[model samples]
Structures are given as structure tokens and as C-alpha cells.
Target chain A: MKTPVYISHPGLVTPLGLGVQQNFTEITNGNIAIQKHSRTDIAKEPFYAAMVSEAAINEAFKSHGAISEYTKLEKMMLLSALETLDNSEVKISDKTLLIVATTKGNIDVLDKDSAFNSERAYLPNLAKTLGDFLGVTATPVVISNACVSGILAVAVAKRLISSGGYDNALILSGDLVSRFTLSGFQSFQAISDLPCKPYSKYRNGITLGEAASSVFVSTIKPTQFAVQVLGDGSCNDANHISGPSRTGEGLFKSVQDAMKEAKIDAHEVDFISAHGTATIYNDEMEAIAFNRAALHGSLLHSLKGIFGHTLGASGLLETVIALEMMKQELILPSTGFDTLGVSKPLAIVETIKHQPINILLKTASGFGGCNTAVVFKKVS
Target chain B: MRNGALFAEIDAANFEGFLKQLYVMLDCKYPKFFKMDTLSKLAFMGAELLLSEISENSSEHKRTALVFSNRSSSLETDRKHQEAISSHGEQYPSPAVFVYTLPNIGVGEVAIRHKLQTENAFFVFETFEPEFLQKYTVSLLNENKCDQVLCGWVEVDGNERHGFFYVVGRNGKWKHSAATIKNFFEHD
Candidate 1:
């Protein structure tokens, strides 16, 4: 029998707040962190986004004292990982692996006014720096598959542990809202003028955000809360580079594969944490995919409204939030979603409710037509 | 395993001509080839040369996975995208250039070309590690997550571009092992 991987102690630093408890409180309270910002460094026009404050980041690092030069993004990643590793028996030894997931790590370094070296912009270099900070002895792995990077990192970690390559894996997923990313999204006309209303009739586009979230994937069960990674799968749409597949082919297949691997029926999934970017095509495609997969009736929610689309960080961060929700046995409403928008109908959670969530499925779809689905079961 | 490999080192000045030469050599008619950025172009040409022999079947396509890695990620297109937006107050970002700024788009290009709806992953390492590549591929196969996998390193550094793509499956003359992959890249 293969070793089972359990997720434990997820650390999150988002615009919502630091750590899981604070973010969970805000999420359950139906509070949103997205706000309009006119940062000259990001864009000339005012863009609505969820941005982690520099004060919060500096405050998080103050207790650790100064280390050598580390960029803001690096500091965010380190702080989140440190929070997850604190008071844990897990050791950063050779048996432990590090997987850093991001779309554009340190892309802000590309700016002419930036002081950090351009080399730090490389994903592998960023991974190495994070590995060194954590004292990981093995070569760090970097996953940069657009928005799916974070959720896919968890899948990769689970597979590695199941394959007996490592006993534990530290998975950190993050991305910052920089001029580069903002410009790219604007170019695609996928940026929302207002807070994104995912799967809503009036939804326009995504509200970008920045965050760093960490989850420790290990074979050993934790003393506290944890979830078992039952199964995971990824598929490409083979359709478009930027737009989601019109037929939702990749996502449907990915969900089917994950369910098959988990040896469960669609009815077994108590709830779903979906990737609802609120873009017309993406949300519509997800609805089509979920319907086709027979998950249309499941209680589903997208956390994008609370934490605007966090790009690479969305997948893992959302998973972490789902874990907390599972422990609380509460289903948070899909904020910003009011009316059904897509062609196919979906059971978008519209009200916060205290309900038992035994098995939850997390799915993410991103640019380059990538889709990933991972199924997790609550530990009793 | 049924496998193929190709490599190209453009003179940097005539990179377009080199790509055109590859297009002619492969006898491919995909016009989208010219629209792709440099990184996608390299990956596209490599996939064409590597997967040219595999027959297309609906079920087989679903069983094949594309796993790739690189050192530069998408630096080539990133610089261009950055240039477009920051060009002396031009502030005009091209949607085309912005789309290719992510490294995994190369895998998307190949997936679109061949219609591969299988498991795909892209990793970034300082340098190519044969062991990681081989182990990951084998794990997928062992778990029955995939029946076949096309994986290797595709890198683009300035004027220099190199790609080593090979197919691994139950049927093939070349064995899918770390040493074999190392030998294939080392041979050229």
C-alpha cells in the first residue's frame, strides 16, 4: 500500500490577515479584502485588488530580526513558511522536500527602479533562496504553471510522499500584484473594474491579489487538525493559451480522473472549492465542467471574492482555507455571487451555514488551459 | 520506448530564419507557429520532431503526459513583454506578448498542436536533473496516472537554444531510464 499524505498547519499571509485563524474569521464573517488602489508601481489607472500591506510583512519579520538582503516577495514566502513550521516537530532535513509554486516570482525586480538583482526573478533561483532559508538539503523544486501552480504543488507533494521519495514536503505558493502581472491581465481585458463576482450574472472579470500561503504535506499524521489527500489529477485543455476551453474539456477530465483515483462517486464530495476567476469564459467553463462531472448539486464556493484572484497563490491558499472551514464544519458563502450567471446551473453557496463537510474537492484552472483537481477527506 | 530528439543553436541574428528552416524541414503546416514567442517556438519545433512518429488515437492522446522543465523559464518573452509596456512612455502592452510570458505556455503550445489532454507539469530547476525527471515520469506510469509520457528539458538562453525531448511508453527500443535520458542528451 502507498503511503498517505496528510496536510497540516497551513500558513497564510493575505490581505485578509496573517495566519489561518484571522483569515478564517474574516472569511466566515463575509468580509472582503479587495479594495481600489492607485499605486503608480502597479498601474496608472485605479485597479481594484487585494494587496498585502508592507507594514504587515515588515511586522511579521520584525521578530525574526534582519537577515541578508531578501526581496519583499521572498520575505512574504519565508514568513508564511516559518509560521507553518513553528512549534512543529517536522525537520527540514534531506528527507524533507521543498516545492515553491508561483507564476511570477519577484517579477517586480524587472522594474528599472528596483534595487534587487534581476537574477532573483528566475523561479528556480527564488526556489533556491527559499530552500536555503528553510535549511532544505535537497534541490528545491519550482512549479510555475500559471494559476494552477499552488493546487498542483499539493498534488505533486502528495505523489512524492506516496512514491516514498520524501517523508515531508513544504509547499509554499505565492504571487504578487506587480506592474508586469497587472499589465498582462489588463492586456487580456480580464481585469475587473469592481470586486469580482464569480459565477454571478453581473460578473465582469478578475480582481487580482497578492498572498503567500504554505502547507506542510507529510506522511506522518499531525497532533492537531489535518486532511488526507485522497487523490489528485491535472489535465490540459489542449485548446487555448489564454482563454479557458469553451467545452471545459480539460477540467471535466481532470475532475473525472480525481474522482476515479479517490474511488468515490460525485455524491461523495460534500463540498467543492472551485476556481471561479469571475471572467465570463472561465466561470462559464467551470460551470459546464462541474455539471458534466455530476458535481452540479454539491455545495460549491469560490473564495476569490474574499481574496481577489491571488493568481499562483489562489490554489493552495484556497485549499488551506477549505481545511479550516472543514474543521469548523461551516460552509462560507461564495461572496460576490448573487445570481446564477453561467449557462449551466450550479449550487453556488449563497449563505454561510454550519454544516458538516466530510469530503471536499478543490479544483483550479488557469492560463495555458491547465486544470487540476485534488480530493481531500476530513480526518476524524 | 519510441523516441526522437532535436536541437538547434541559432546564430541569434538569424533566429527567425533558423525557425523557418525547422518549419520547412519538418514539413508542418501550422501557421500559428510564427505567432508564438521564441520559447514556444523552440518547444513547438521540438515536440513536432519528437512526436512525429506517434499515431494519434483518442484514448492514447488522453493517456500521454507532457512533463517539461527549464532554467530560463520564460525570460525571453518576459523581456519582450516588459519592453512593450515600458518602452519610453509607450505603456502599450501587446496581448500576444503578454500571453507567452509564462514558461508553461510552451507545454500548452505542444498540447494544442497534438491535442494532448493528459497530465502536464512544468518545473524549474537550476539545471537539468535526470533523476528527478526520470523518477517523476516513472511514478506517473507506475501509478497508472499515465500510460506514456513525453518529458525532457527545453531551454532558451539568448541566441542559444537547446531541446531534448523523447517519448516513454511500454513499447520502445530505447529504455526509459535516467542513464538513458542522460546519454541521449549527452550524445548530441
Candidate 2:
């Protein structure tokens, strides 16, 4: 209980805007990142994606110095992590544990005829590459549990720091949104022609996006930050390998467990960061889950509207965005929302602003029925 | 609570012995679900043996959750799934073979048998990272989404399977501890 894991600082690079300050201000102003996807020839499917500008990615690598070929997904990782380290004024070293969260590390590189070794798809190799880039040879632990990877990474880093294994742990999450994911999601038919609209009526499918974020979690008790990770829960639906449960039963238990862990009631949550992918089933299931859990947040939204669905990066990426939202005193509007979809009468953030963030519930679900929820309270 | 673990080892010679060991463990339950019919079934068999009586109850369909990780992600199933697509045209592959493509789906099958309408998640790592295993397990436990977590490392190669499980508790608020392998692989 003495482990004061404070989010000293956060860094992010996404389609919305690069740099933590830029994104934070935009999030406060309720800016959205929806844009038509670049290069639509492969499947040629009509869809929108919140794509990061190549100029921003190039600038990130330049600032980090020449990234070696061995470092898979280093481009995105360095961009976000460096931003965090710079913002937090923390130095990276052997003493700092670099915990990376990702699903596909470098599968994108392997797909193309790249010069680097294609075998970086494995876990340890990918970890080493990331650690090497940070000038820390200490083994990086990569958590690859489909979409809920951010909370998964947080869980891992929290244990290490709280257990006195490391002085500081960097929770970095990103996805190298590859042709594989696009093709796979396309095959599953989970993509929407229009931008994804979560939790509202006339909601379409999800639009995929990419993000890399770094959060400096330390055992320091700071009285100023807006939020802290009070509790977290993750469970496998065990219902279907590829599809989510019809009842959202797994998500219910996860929320219940997280609340029990946090020692709070459902009514205490001021806002809920739902995993509203805008898919017909995913949205319906979440709507059903909220009603069954009897959980209501004063204001609710899915950052997927702003960042698209960053897949594995969605959990932490959205969580990081939520923290920034807390700092900015805003509850972001759910972008791409048109009308109400489910009968739950839940307050889905459809317009451009909701305010005064205090206690928030964040949830994310993935393939293999992986569902996770984490509670963050404003650390005043 | 120091739980006494039952470890049953099986090789070519103790194949029948393994079956008998499983039978005794099942406690008069129907033996058909213990589908140790082939070399491909060792993980299913070994995991079944490890769970002993806990897995054979009437609540086998949905009440139970499967949490497993491995280096070899269904090599046997992958070869067969590929063969079906290759032989019977790419579009018309066997649904039975195509279904087990993910390493975590076996848990769903076990849940379908148990009625475990709870949280089930699968982790894929190079070798089991102790920090990842302990933290992830504790998170699920602390959340109270899962009553008993069957966290383990299960490996299968040819006719051999080596796997272990530790049924741990999250209710104690062991949220963020860098638990050692003893905490993860050892119970009691």
C-alpha cells in the first residue's frame, strides 16, 4: 500500500495532434481526429482512420536519433516515450523498468520484404529491441493480450513498482496497425465505411487508428495530479474465441470486480470511458452491460471517436487521453455519433463537451473475449 | 491456505497409467470428456489431470474459465487447418479446424462444457514472464470478476505436454506485487 504509483507525466502522438500539450489542449476543446484513411487500394474499402502524419513520426525518430532496424515498432514507441520522458524530466536507465504493451510488434515489417530480421515477431526479441532503443539493456516485458494491452501493461508495471522490484516503470503502449490487422478486421467485416460512432443511434462499425503513448509511473505521492489508478480488472469472456458474448456477462463481472477492488459503488463513477467500438454487437453488448450492472456515469464517451480504434493500444491510449481529459476538466464528446442505438437511456457523450471529470471508469474488450476495466480517481 | 497439489506424470510407458490416474481423479464421472485419444490431446489430457476433480463437475460448461499460454501456439491444429484449406480450396476449410486458430479458444471449449460466464483472457509470451503473470492474475482477482483463476503455463510438442496451474486469490488485495515464480507456479 506504500507504493505511490503516480502518473507524473504523460506523452502521446496520434492523429489528433502530436505532443502531450497539443493533444491535451485539443481534448479540452473537444477536437476530433476523424479523417479518410490514406491509401485505400488493398481491400479498397471505404473507411475513415485517425492516421498520424508522416511528418510527425519522422520528427519523433529524428529527435530520438537514428532508430536501428532491430527496434520493431520503435518509431511509434520512441515518439511517445521520449515525449513522456522529456515532459516528466525523468532519465531512462537500467534502474527504470520499460514495460511495453503491444499486440503485433513488427509483423508489419515482416509482411513487407524488409532488410531486418523478420523474427522480431516473438516477445523477447521485440522486448530487447525496445529496451535497446531506450539505452537500457534491461529486458523489457511486452504484454500482448489483444486489445486490452494497456491495462495489462499497467497491471504488470504496477506490480513491479509496488513490489519494490523497480524504482520507476514506464508504461508504453502502441500498435503498428498493419495490413494484417486491416485485412483481418476486414475479413471479420468489423470495419465501417463511415467514421465509427460509439453508443449513439445509427452507429456504424469502428475505424482503425494507431497510437504510441508513454506514461511515467513512479512511487511518488504527488498531491496535484487529477487522477490515479485505484483499481483494475480483466477477464476472458470464454464465450467465443472471435466474438464477444451476447449478454456482456464477462464485462459485468469485470466491472463488479474492479469496483469491489476499488471499494466503491457503481454510483460513484462520474464518467465512464466505454469500449464502444460502434460495431452492431459491441455497442449493443456494452449497452446491455451498463443496464445490467446498474452503473451510470455522469458523463460518458469513447476516445475511439477521436483516435479511431487503436486496437491493442486502445486501452492505454484511451486511458492516457482520459487522464489528460481529467487534467483539462473536460469529458470528451463521442465523435461520429448520430442517434441513440440501445434502449439503456445511458448518457453517451454525443456532442462536443462534458465537464468536471473526477472519478472515471475505463473499459476495453478484445478478440478472444478479453475484457478489462480500470478505475482512476482524481488525485487531489 | 496451503493447497496440496496433485502432479501426475505421463510418458510412453505410463500412458495407461496416466489414463487410470485421470479416471481416479474424475471420481465416477463420464470419461468421454477426457479426450486423450491422440498425441494432439496431451495438453487437454495434462490440463485435465492437473485440475483433477475440479474440472469434471456438472458446472463444466460455462462456469469455468481457461487461462493458458504457450510458445507453440497450436502447431498441430495449424498444420491441419492449413491442410484443409490447401486441399479443399482456400474458402471451404473445415470450420472445426478453423475455429481453434487462436491459442486461447481451448478455454472457451472448456467453458462451453462448464457454463463459466465469467472473465477469460489468454496471454501469449515468449516464455512466461513472472511479473506479467502475477500482475495480470491479481488484476483480474482484485477486480472480483473471476472467483478462481486457473493461471498456468502449458506447452505441447509432438506427443509430450508440460503444464502447471496455480489457483490463486485476488480478493486479498494483492494488486501490485512482483510475485516470484514460487507464487505463480507453486501453490500452498
Most accurate candidate by TM-score:
1
Among all windows of ten consecutive residues in candidate 2 chain A, which has the lowest summed lDDT? Answer: A37-46
Write candidate 1's Cα lDDT for A318-338 as tens digits.
999899889989889999998
Interface RMSD of each candidate, angstroms, one decimal: 0.9, 4.3
Q: What is the DockQ of candidate 2?
A: 0.26
Against the true two-chain complex, what DockQ does each candidate achieve? 0.77, 0.26
Stretches of candidate 1 exceeding 4 Å from the true structure:
A65-68, B1-13, B58-62
| Model 2 agreement with the true structure over A1-380: per-residue lDDT tens digits | 43556665777878766677887777657676777755643234455777776666675577557645434366777777777767364556676877777766555544434556646655456666666767775556656667787776675565456556677788778875555556556656677878788876777688888888878776765556735667666666657656788888778877876777677888888889888898888888887777777875456778777788887788888778788778777667777677888767678776546467778888888765778887778878
